[model samples]
Target: MVVEAKNTTSPHNMNQVDVNSDDRRDEQVPLLLQYWQAVSRYRIGIACIVLGTIALGIIVTLLMTPYYTATSRIEINRNQDKVTNVEGLEAEDVGQNLEFYQTQYALLEARSLADRVVRSENLATGDAFFQTFNVDPDENGIISGSDSRQSSEDRRRRFELAIRLLLDNVSISPVRGSSLVDVSFRSPDPQLSASIANAWVAQFVDSNLDRRFDSTIDARKFLEERLAQLRARLEDSERRLVRYADNKEIVTLSTTRDAEGSTVGGDTLISSNLAALNKALTDATADRIAAQAQADQNGLNKDAIENPAINGMRQKRAEIASEYAKILVQFEPEYPTAKALERQISDLDESIEKEELRMRTGALTRYSEALKRERNLQNQVAQLKSKFSGERQDTIQYNIFQREVDTNRQLYNGLLQRYKEIGVAGVGSNNIAVVDPALAPEQPSSPRILLNMALAMLMGLGLAGAYVVVSEQIDQTIKDPSDLKNRLNLAPLGSVPDMRKDDIISMLQDKKSVAWEAYISIQTSLSFLTSHGAPRSFLMTSTRPNEGKSTSAFALAAVLSSTNRKVLLIDGDMRNPSLHQMIDQKNVQGLSNYLSGDDDIDNLIQKMPDQGFWVMTAGPIPPNAAELLSSPRIKKLFDHLEEKFDCVIVDAPPVLGLADIPLLANAVEGVIYTIEAGGVKVRGIESALRRVRSSHATIFGAIITKVKSSGTGYGYGYDYQYSYGQQDPLPAPSA
Candidate 1:
C-alpha cells in the first residue's frame, strides 16, 4: 500500500498555515497552527469553562453573610495616687493601666460576672441573643437537652470565648500615655455588640468590689481567733515573771538605772566569762594531749608526781634544801651533819603542812568563785526572761491590733481598688472603644448581578480550567490529535470541523457551506494515505467513548459515499453502536447476531437510500463480543466485505478497555483513529497507541475531528473570492 503525508508544503515563519502560500513559512508557523487547531477544536470546552465560572460566583455571593461591629473603651489604674512616678511610663498612667487592666481583664471573664450578666440580661429560653451569647454548660462534658441545663462553668467559658472572639474583633489601646483603654466588639447586631462590651466592663468592676467585701469578712474572723490566743499568752508570761522575782528574794526593780544598767552589764559579763572558761578548757585539753605524747604513756599515774599540785610541793622542798645547804656552809662536818639534815627536813615538812592547809582552804574559795559565776549566769537568765516577757506581751497586743485593722482595711482597700478601676474605665479611654458606629449600608452588599454574572462566568471557566488541568493530569484519555501524534508517533491524517454551525447544512441543501468545503478538503486529504491498489479496509478507533469516534466514522463514510461509489460501513464497536442514530436504521439484529448465531447476513444488513451505502451494526450488547470478533469467522467476513465494497469503514470500540480491537485488527488492512483536537491528554494517546502496537495493528494515521475554519479567502496570490458561510469548492482551472 502506498502511504503519504498531508499537504507536502508546510506553513512557516509567520506562525500560520498558508493556504495563501504554496510553501511552508519558517517563523513559528507550527505553533500558530497548533493554537488555531486548539481553539477551533475545543470551543465547546472553553464555553463550558466560562459558563461554570459565572454560575459559581453568583451562588457564592448570594450565600455569604454580612456582619457588623461596635465597641467601647476603658482604662486601668495601678494606683490612683502612684501614677505620676512610673518611669518611661510617663504617659500619665499607661504602665499602671496595663498592669491593672491585665488583672481586671482576667476578672472580666470570671464566673461570678458571667453568671450575673446571664441572669441580669434574661438571655435564655429561645432568645436569639441568648442562643448567640448564652453558653450551655456540659455537666457530662457534652452539651445536650433543652434550655435550662446550662451550668455556670459553661456560661463562663462561653463568655470568655466570646470575650476572646470579641477581643480578637475588639481593639484596645491606651490613650498615648494615659490609663485609658479603648474597647471594641464585633457581632451580627451592632447595638448588642456595644451593649455586651460595656456590660463586661461594669460587671468586672462590681465583682472586684464584692471580692473585697468577702476578703474583709474572712480577715475579720481570722483576727478574732488570733486575739483570744494572744491575750492568754500575755497573761501566762507575766505570771511566770512575777513568780521568778518573788522566789529569788530580789526586788522586781522597775525603771531603775542600777538594775537596768547592771542587768544588761551582767548579761555581757556572763557571756564573756563563759567564753573564757571554754577557752581555758580547750587549752587545758591541748596541754594534756601534748604532755602525754611527749612522755609516751597512757596513764597519768607515772607523770602525776609532775602534776601541777605535786610540782608546787617539790619547788618548796627545793627551797628548804637550799637553805640547809647554806647553813652547812658555816657548820663543822663532824659536829652534827645528820642533825642539821633532820632539822631542815622537819622544817620543810612543817612548811608543807601549812602549804597543804592553804591548798585545802582554796577548795572552798574555788567553790565560792563557781557559785559567783552561777549567780552571774542566773542574773543574765533573769534579764532575758524579763525582756522576753515584755516583748511577748507587746506581740500579743500587736497581733490582735493588726488582725482587727487588717480585716477592716482589706475591705476598705478592695472597695478603693474597685472604685479606681471603675473610674479608669468610664473615661471612654479603656481598651476597645468604637471610634465610629455602624451605619446602614448605602447599597446591598450582595446580589451584584453584573459582577455575579462575570464572576459566575469566571467561576465556570475556572472549574472548566480545573477540570481540563485535572483531566489532562489524571483522566488519561487520548482526546487531542497532537496528543495522539506526540504519543503514538503517527502522522495526523486530517481534521473534521464542527457541524453545529450552519455551514454543513447549507452545503448539503444548496451546495454552499464552509462545512461542505471542510469535509471535501478532509475527503481529499484522506486520499494521501491510500490510492489505486493501495486503497484498503480502514480501521476507525479511539481511546474512549464520546470522543467523536461514531461521528467521524459516519461523516467519513457519508463523504466517501457522496462519490456514488459502493461503500460499506461496518460497526465493529460491539460495545456501543451509534451509527443507527445517524442512519435512522432500526438495529434489532446485526453483526453480533451474524457472528454468534446462524443468522443470515442478507437480512441483518441495512441500506441508506440517499447515500447508497451498507451498514453493519452490533445489534444488542453481546456477552462474548471479543471472542466472536477474534474468531476466524470474522476474518472471513472482512475478506468478503472488501471484495464487494469499494471501501469498508470499521467503527471500533475504545482501545484501552476491550481486547476486541486488537483481536479484530489482525484481519484488517490498515487502521484510522478518530481524534478530537485538544480534547484528550498526550499520556492517554500514548497508552492507547501502545496497546494498539501490542496487538500488532497497522495504523493508517488519524482523522482529526471538530475543527473550526476561518472563512477568509486569499489563495496563494490567486485570489478566490467567495461569500461567507459558503462551503463549495471554487471552479476548477479552465481545461
Candidate 2:
C-alpha cells in the first residue's frame, strides 16, 4: 500500500509560495525579435520562393530579345521666330503657352506625322522594317496577292501598319519648365532607332511648316476676297456722299479726323458764314448798349460834360464874377461896372448851354445809328443760321454716308495690309528644332539585368511576406504558452523542453536534466494553483493521444517525490495504457483490476524504487472503459488514495472521442492539461478543454510540453531556457 509522509509545510505556507509565483511569466519581448524568430521558422521556404523568382527573372532576361533605344533631343518654342516684321495670320497669345506646348507635343505624336516619317523613309516597302519589329507581312493582313484590288488594299494596309509601327516605337518626352523635348525610338536595330528618332523630329518640323504655310495661303485668299468686297463698298459709299453733298449745295469747308484717320465731324460754307456774322452781331450789340446809355443820361456822361468849348466858357464866367464882386464892394449898388460883369457871366453860361445841347443831339443820333446797325447784323446772322440749319439737315444723310465710307475704307485698308503681310510672311518660321541629333546606341536599352533583378527581388520579398502572414493565420497550433491564455483563456503552468530523443525516463531520474527542472517549476506552480496549495489529486490529460501527457504524469510524480512527498501516479487510460510500458513495469493488475471490484488496492499499486513513486498502470484493456470510469468505484478509489499519498496524479486518456477523461476528472481535485507544442490545433484543444470543464472539474493550468530550445519551436515569442550546469546547446528536435 502507500505510506503518506507528514506534511512539513502547512497549506498556508505553500499557498503563499504559489501566490508569489502566480503572476504569469509574461516578459516584454522586443517585437522585432519576435518577428525575426517567426520569419526564421520559414526561412527555407522563403529562400526557395525568392531564389526561384530571381532565377525566373534571369531566364526571362536571357530569353528576351535585345532592343536598342535612340534619343533625339529637340526644342519646341511656343512661338515661331518671325522671318519678317509683318505678323502671321495665326496670332499667338502669351497666356496660351501651355496649350501651345501641349499642342506641339501632341502634333509630334500625331498619326499624320508618323505617316510622313514612314513614307519619307519608305518603310512600308522595306522588309528590314517589318523584320526589326518581328512582324510577318503575310500574317498581318498585308499580303499582296495577284488580285489588283486586293493588292491595292493590302498596300494600303501595309502603309497603315508601318505608320502604326513607327508611332509605337516613337516616344516624345517634354522637359519640365522648359521648351525642350526628347524624341526617342526603340527597335532591334540601333541604326534604325537612330534613323527613326531623327526622322520623327524632322518630319514633325516639316509638317508644322506645311500646316503654317497652308494656313497662311488660306488666310491670304480669304483676305483678298474680303478686300475686294470692302473696296467696292467703299467706292459706292464715297460716291453717294459726294452726290448728296453736291445736290444740297452743302460744300464742306473743313473736317475733323480721329487718331485712326476716320471722319469724326465736318464744317460747311453756310456754317462758316453764320459763325462770322454771329461775331459781328455780338460787337454791334455791345456798341448800341453804350450809346443808348449815354443818350438816356441827357449829357450826364463824363465825356459829354467835359466838352472843350463849354469848359472854357465856365472858366471865363468865373473870372468875370470874381471881378464884378470886387468892383461892387468898392462902388455904388447900381454901378455900370457891376452890370457889365453880370452880362459877361450870362454870355458865358449861354455858350456853355449851347455846347451841352450839341453834345446831347450827337449822342442821340449815334445811339439811333448804333441800334440800326445792331438790327441789320442780327438779321444777317439769323439768315445765315437758317441756311446753316438747312445745310445741317442735309448733312445728316451725308454724315451717314461718310461714316459708311469711312468704315468700308478702314476695312479695305486693314484687309489689304493683312494680305500684304501674309504674302510676305509665306510659311513663317519653324518653331521646332533638333537640339541633339540621335546617334546609333552602342548598348541595348531593354532586358536590363540589374533592373530586372531588383524588380524580381522586390516581388520575391512581397510574396514571402504574404506567405508568412497567411501561414501565421492558417496555423492554429499552440505554438507558445501565450496561446494558452490567448486562444483558450487558460493560464500557463510551465513549459517542458522537448527531450523525446534523449531517455525521458533517465532525464526524469536525473535532477540535473532540463526536463526534470521544467517539471519542478510546474510542480511549484501547481502548489500555488489554489488556496490549499496543489490539489491533493489532479488528472493529467491532453486533447489527443501521444501529446506527452503520460510522460508529464511520470515527470510530475518524480518531481514531487524529490520533495520527500509520497506521490501516486495512476494510469487512468485503461483504453490504451502507456505508463507501464514507459516505466518498463509489468501491468498484470492495476487500476482496471481495482475498479473491477478486486478490493485490493495494495496489490494493484506498484512502487518504482528508482523514481521514489508508486504507479498504478492500466493493467487490461476494458471494452467499457467510459462506463467503468463512470462507476462510483472510481471516485471511491481516488478518495482512498488521497489519504494514503501526499499527491495523486491520474494520467487519463485524451479528452477527444472519449468520455473517460471527464469521468476521471470528476474523481480528482482538478485537471492538469498537458499540451504538446505545435501538436494539436487550438480548436481541438479548446474542444477537449470544453469537455473537461463540463465535468465541473477545476483546471489548474496547462503544461506546454516538447518545447524546442529555439524560441521558434513553441511560438516565436517564447524564450524560456532551462540549462543544467555548463552543457553545450542541444540540437533542435525535428518536427
Candidate 3:
C-alpha cells in the first residue's frame, strides 16, 4: 500500500500547523496549568530559594531590637473661649478649620516644641536618655568631662542632640473627622517611651499657653500706646468743639448716639427755635384765609343765616308785605291801612339789614386780626431762619470737631475695653485638653514573626519567577513532546523515556517493560501517520547523532514484528553503523555491499535468532557513503525488501553535517524524525529538518526520545540509551 502524507515542507503550511497545534494545546491545557508545568521543572530550586529566604527573614527578625510605643491623645479646640465681648486679634474663619488643625498638628512636631520637651524633662543632662536609645553619649561629645568652655560646648551639643532625637522619635497622628490628635513616641525602653509621650503633650500645651500670653503681651502694649495717643486726641478735639460752638453762639439742644455710644449728630438751639415759629406761622395763615373768605361774601353771610333774631325778623316782614299788598289791591292808592302795613314791613327790613351788616363787620375785623397775627408769625420765622442759616454755616466746623471727638472717644473706649480683656486673657486658659495619657506598653510593637515570613515568601516567589522566566528565554531546547508540535511544527508520534542503566536490547525482548510498551505506543502512532496502516517502508533520522534514532528504529521494528509480520531493521549509515552492534552481528555485508552493486540482497539481510525481526548492517564502511546512498540501487534494494518483509525501517545517518540521510530518504516510504528531548536546540532541529525536506522527503511525524518522565508527563519511566561512533573521513574520490 502506498502511504500518502501531507506536504509540510512549506513555511506557510508549517506555520499553519504550528498555529493549529498551539490552539488545540491551549484548549486542552489551561494556561495556568502550563505555567505550573513549567514551574514544576524547577520546583526543587524554587522551594530551596523560598525556604532560604524565609529562614533569613527569621534570623534577621530575631536579631532586630524590639521597640515599644506609647501614645497620648488630646482634644485641640480651633477657637479659644472669650472672656469678654471684645473681639480677639486673630479672627477665626469657620471654613479654615482644616488649615487651623493642620497647623496645630504641625506645631505638635515642631523642633521648637521638641527643644521645649527636652529642656522641660531635663533629658540632656543625663546619660540615661542616651542609654535608653542604645546611643553612646561620649561618641557625640555629650556629657564630656572636659574644660569649662569645652563642657559648655558639649552641653550645647547634647541639648541639640536631645532635641533632634526627640523630634525623630515623636509622631503626630490626627483623628479623622475630629479635633483630636495623638502624640506617640517610640523607644527601646518602655518607660522612656511613655515618659516622652506624656512630656511631649505637656510641653506642647504649655507652649501654646505661652504663645497666647506672649501674643497678648504685645497686643496689650500696642493698645496702651494707642490709648494714650487717643486720649490726648479726644481732649483736644472736645476743646476745639466747645470753643467753636461758643464762638458761633451755637447751643446744643439734642443729640443722637449710635449703638457704640458715639455721638452721630446734634441739633442747635437756633435751629429748634426756627422749627417752632415756622409751625405757628403755618397755623395762623390757615386761620386768616378762613376769615377772609367769610368777609368777601356778597350776600348775608353764614353767621347771619344762622342767627335766630334775624330769622324771626325776616318772617315778620314776609307777613307784613303780604298784608300791604292785600290792602293796596282792595283800597285806593292813598289808603291809610295799606300805608300802615307797608311801614311795618319797611321797619322789619331795616332790622334784618342791620343784623346782616353787624355780622359782616365782625367777619372783617376777625380777618384783619388773623392777617396781622400771620404777618407777625411770618416775620418771626423769617428772622429765626436767617439766624439758623448763619448758625448752620458755623455748626459745620463745630460738627467737624464734634465728629473728631466722637471718633477719638470711640477708639479710646474700644481700646480701653480691649485692654481690659487682654489683661484677663493674658492669663491664658488651656485650649488643648488631654483625653488619654500614655501608659507604658507591656509589649513591643514590631518584629512580628508571621508577617515577616509572609513577606519573605512573597519576595522569594518573585525572585524565583524571574529566574524561571530568564532560564526559559535562554534555554530553547525541546522540553516535552508538545515542543515538537509547537516549536518544530511537526506532529508528535510518541515519547520514549530514558533507561540508560538498563539493557535496552533485553528490555525490547521483554514485552512487559516500560521501554517495550513505549515503542508499542509509538508503533500505534506510526500506523496512523499515513492514510494506510504503518508504512510499508520508512526511515528514521535525527538532527544529530546518538539522538536514539538507531534504537528507535530497532524498537519499532521489533514491535512491528511482534504483530506476526516479517520486519526488517536496516542500518543505512554506512559511515557509522550501530545496528550490527545492537543485534550482536558482524558488519561483514549489508546495504553498502548491496548499493555497491553486489546485488546479493538476500544474503546481505540477516534474521535475528529467537527474534521475529531481521537486521541489515551498513556492512563495511564505505569511502563515499553519500555517493553510494544516492544511487538508484538503494531504491531497488528498498523495493525488494518491501516485497520480502512486511515492514522496513531504515536507521539513516543524522541530517546535519551529512548528506547521506537526505539521499537515502527518497528510497523509503516516509521519514520518521526522531528528536532527543532537551538535547538539540529548536534552531538546530529546524535546520536539520529543512535540509531533509529540501530533498522532498515526506516527514510522517516526530518521536521524542529519552524524555524525562518528570519533564514531560507523557513519557514512561524507562530511558533508551544509544551512542554514535565518529564518522570516518571520506577517502578522496578515486582519480
Candidate 4:
C-alpha cells in the first residue's frame, strides 16, 4: 500500500501536524444508485398495468346494464254547467273560473273517483299481470315475487296501492293561461298506460258531477234555513219597534216641522210675558221715583205719595193753585195768601180725590194689568197644547199600527215569495260547475328514460371524482420529475427513460437500435452533468437498499469505457456486498483485507475479463465500517485510485442510520444520490442526503428511479389506442 500524506490542520503551527482522518462518514453512493437503478428497473409495474387494464375492462363490462322507455300527451279543460249560448258569458261572471278551477282540482283528489278507477280498471289485478310482466305465475294465479293479500279488503287496498303508484307516475298541469291542462304519464307498457289515462278522464267527469250535485244540495238546504232566520228576525224587529212607538205617544217625532213650530211658539210666549212684566216694572219704578223726588223736595213720605194719600195731597194742591190763580187775578197777593190756601182746601181735595178715585186707587192696578194679560195668554197656550196632545197620541198609535202592518206585510211578502218559489221547485245554486275535468295520464311523467340515464351517468362521474379526491388524500408517494422540479426545487436532468426489456436486450445484444442510440445519448448527458469531463471519484448510494446505483454506476462506467476512459468500479458497501456477487468474485481479499494491511497494492488489485474494468469488492463484512472508511488508510486508497483510473466509482452502503457511506463520501470527488419511485419516504431521502452533505462530500444532482414504460414517455405505444398485437418492430441504431 502506498502511504499518501494526509491533509492536516496544524494547531501548533509546527510540522507536528494532526489530521481529521475524515471523521465524517462517506456518502451512501450504493443506496442512492440502487434506488435510481430500481427506478429504471420497473418490469413488475408494466405487468401490473397490463393485468389491471384487463381486470378493469372485465369488471366494467359485467356491471353495466341497458335500459328502454315509452311516452304520450293530453289536454284538460274545465267544464261549464248551465252553459249559456249568450255572448260574454265569461265576462258576465268575472273571476268565476278562478274559484271553479281550484275547487275542481281539489275534487279530483276524491277517494270515490280513486275507487271507481280501481274497480273499473281492476287495478287490483297486478297479481294477474305476472305473465305479462314475465313474472312466474303461481298455482293460485298470484305473481311469484308478490305477497298474497289476506281478504277482499286487503286485495282492494293492494289494488289502490297499485293505482296510487301509477297515479304518482302521472302529471297534470295547466298549460299557461289557457283553460287546458296537460296530462301525461309514463309506464313500461305503452298501451296499458294510454288506456288507464283515458279511463281516468271518464271517471273524473262522473265523479265531478256527483260531487257538484251533492255540494249544491247541501248548500241549498243551508241557504233555506238562513232565509227563514232572516225573515223571522226582520218581522220581530218591525213588531217591537211598532209597539214601542204606540206606547210612547211619540207621534211622528218630526224633528224638522215640530222643532220649528215649538221654537216659534216658545219665542212668542216668552217675549210677550217678558215685555209685559218689563213694562209694569218700568211704570211702577217711574211712579216711585217721582214720589220719592217730590217727598224729598217737600219733606213728605215717598210711600204716602205712592199710595192714595200722596195722590190726594197732590190733587188738593192742584185745586188750590187753580183757585188762587183765579183769585189773584182780582185781589192782591197779601189779601189772598190766607183766603185761597186755607178756605175750603180740605173740602176741595176731597172733591178732587173723589173725582179720580178709580185711577188713584192703588199701585196694584199697574201690576194687575200684566198679571191678567199673562194669565190669559197662558190659558190660551195651554188649551192649544192640550188639543194637540190627544191628536199627537192618536197619530203615534196610528203610526205604530201602520208601521207594524207595513213591516209584517214586507216580511210576509218576502216569505211568500220564497215559499212560492219553493212550491214551484225553483232551485237556486251557488256551486260552480266543472268547466274541465282532471284526466288520467297517457304516459309516465317520471323516470324519463334517456334523461334519467344521462343523469345517472353524471352522478357516476361525480362519484368517481369524489373517490379520486379521497384516495389521493390517503396515498403517500414520491410522484414525478415535477415533484422534484417544482416542490423540491432541484434541477431536473433529462430522464434515463424506461424501455422494453426485450428491445433493450436486443439493442444491447445486437448493438443496433434507436433505443441503443438513446443510451449513447444518456452518456452525453452524463458528460454534461459531470462538469467538462473532470476526472473525479464518485460515491453512489440511495436512502435505502435495492436502488439501482450499482447497475447505473456500472452502466455509466461501461458507457464511459465505450469512450475509451479507464473507469474503475469499487464496491464500498461493507454491510451488504452484492456487486462482488454480481462480478462473481467472492472471498477474494480486496478493500477490508487491504485496509488491515493484509496485502500490498499490486497483489490486491483485481480485474474483469470482458471490459478489462478494474473491479474491487468489499473484502469482508466489518463491524466498524464507518470508522474504517474514515481511517487514514481509506484516504490513501482514494489517492491511489485517483491516480490509477480516469473515474473511480465507489458503491457505498445506504446512508440511513449507517455511517460507512458518509465517511467514505467525504473522500470522494462527488456523490450522486438516487431516489426510487413510490418508495423511500421523502423525509428519509432528505435525511440521507443531509448525512452525505454533513460527511463533507460534493454531490451530483439526484436521479429519479423506476421510470415505468407505461407511466412515462417510454410508454408511447399507449398513445396509439392499441388494440392487440400492434407494436412496431425495433430498428437498428444510426451509424
| Best-performing candidate as measured by lDDT | 2
TM-score (all chains, Cα) for each model:
0.35, 0.71, 0.65, 0.45
Candidates' lDDT values, in order? Answer: 0.56, 0.80, 0.80, 0.54
Ranking by lDDT: 2, 3, 1, 4
Tell how far residue 668 is off in model 2, in angstroms. Answer: 3.7
- State model 1's lDDT: 0.56
lDDT of 3 by residue, 161-188 (tens): 8888888888999999888899999999
Cα lDDT over the full model 2: 0.80
| Tens digit per residue, CA lDDT, model 1, 344-463 | 678767766665555545444544555555556556556655655554454444334434444444444444444344333323222333344334333443356687787677667666
Deviation (Å) of 687 in candidate 4: 5.1
Whole-model lDDT, model 4 = 0.54
Residue 560 CA displacement from its true place in model 3, Å: 14
Per-residue lDDT for 1-735 in model 2, tens only? 121121223344334434433466444345786678668868888998899889989999999999999999999776667778777667668426577778887888889998899889988875678878878665655644333454666678778889888888788898988889999999999999999999888888888778878888788778878888888898999899888888999888899999887999977888888888889889899989989998988868766667777777878888898898899889874798888888888888888888888888988998999999999998998888788788888888888988998899888888888887787774457667788999999999998999999899899988998998898789888866656766787778888776673456776756766677778878888877666667788889998888889888988898898889999999989988988888787778888898788998998898989889999989888778887887889878987999999999998888899988778877777788999987888888888888887866667778888875555434332233455462665445445
Among all windows of 10 consecutive residues in model 4, the one with the lowest summed lDDT is 16-25
Give the clash count for model 2.
3
